[model samples]
Target chain A: SAVISQKPSRDICQRGTSLTIQCQVDSQVTMMFWYRQQPGQSLTLIATANQGSEATYESGFVIDKFPISRPNLTFSTLTVSNMSPEDSSIYLCSGSGRTEAFFGQGTRLTVV
Target chain B: AQSVAQPEDQVNVAEGNPLTVKCTYSVSGNPYLFWYVQYPNRGLQFLLKYITGDNLVKGSYGFEAEFNKSQTSFHLKKPSALVSDSALYFCAVRYPGSARQLTFGSGTQLTVLP
Candidate 1:
């Protein structure tokens, strides 16, 4: 299992502001992904963080709203742009190894 | 597209009683089933997974899941429940040839009573 570290474990941001969450893995991984868990809801996939290319966003999400950067195999970041009250949720980063997947502690964002 | 289904939204059990959380899946190919536990305000912790070669697989925290191909189900189970086991549980699935992104079901909230 890979050890993932995410920064800004909890943050309060004003509406219309943007906050960037960083994820660092202790070892290199092939696939990295971003997910969102809304209040009292299950997780939704935000995007796939490609190592050297643009991140692939899922339906109902776009790069303009959730831009991602995967500089290398061991690091990635997800930035929630132009936040809103509805954007308040827990953001998690996950990495998949050869056999299994692992997750970070997650960042809790509250938009006010 | 692959999908996962957790039939129950919440399950209540008393301590020392066997507990079960139901899950079913749909996939075009061989399925990789996984169970994860999430505590309040925390990320998911991998409990167990069924890759292949075993009908039943055991994992962390004494959790085990049985994979039934005929039923297309992988249900998480524990012999005895504990108050500490109160948490949200999620069932996830992935196809072997797909993008490797896991499709998670709507989680089930498990509450264990004293």
Candidate 2:
């Protein structure tokens, strides 16, 4: 298990605006996962961030809408571009080892 | 592909009584199952996980889960329920070749009446 944290515990933004959430892990990990949990819904993986390479987005998600960046093994950032009301959700970042995965505190984004 | 399913939307238990939250999963290969609890406005906390060895695995917050390979189910249990244990619970699973990316269930809201 690793200590993980996310910046801006929560934020409220207007539609058409974008926000970037940062994820920090205390220790290095091989792979990091990004997920979106809509209000009162299940968690859906947005992408898998790889160190020194582009992220692999899941079906129904795109890099243009949810761009991801992993500069290193311990940190990554996700940007929700052109936000909409439907984009209001908890953005969670997770790090994975060979066996288990650990999550960050999460960023609660509310789009108005 | 690996996936998890939490059949119940919510479960209610009386204080000091045993509680169970049911979960089932599907995977192409062997499964790695996990349980997590989330309090209101808080991040998810790991409850327990079943990797390879034991059918019953214990984890933080006095929570434990049993893995039933035949039925492909993993149910979260607590011997005695507490009011503080009321929260949203999630079941997650990952299979080989997924690189440890877990697929989480919708979640089960558990309420312990005092």
DockQ of 1: 0.78
What tier of docking accuracy does candidate 1 attain?
A: medium
CA shift at B51, candidate 1, in angstroms?
Answer: 0.5
Tens-digit lDDT string for candidate 2 (B1-114): 677899999999999999999999988678889998989988877788898988999998788999999999999999999999999999999886666788999999999999
Docking class for model 2 is: medium
DockQ of each: 0.78, 0.76
Evaluated at residue A65, the lDDT of candidate 1 is: 94
Looking at model 2, residue A15 earns an lDDT score of 100
Question: Tens-digit lDDT track for model 1 on B9-95?
Answer: 999999999999999999977899999999988899999999999799999988899999999999999999999999999999989
State how far residue A33 of model 2 sits from its true place (Å).
1.0
What does candidate 2's lDDT look like per residue over A1-112, in tens digits?
Answer: 7788898899999999999999998775678889999999988999999888889989999999998999987889999999999999999998877777888889999999
Roughly what TM-score does model 1 have, to 2 decimal places?
0.98
Score residue B3 of candidate 1 by CA lDDT: 94
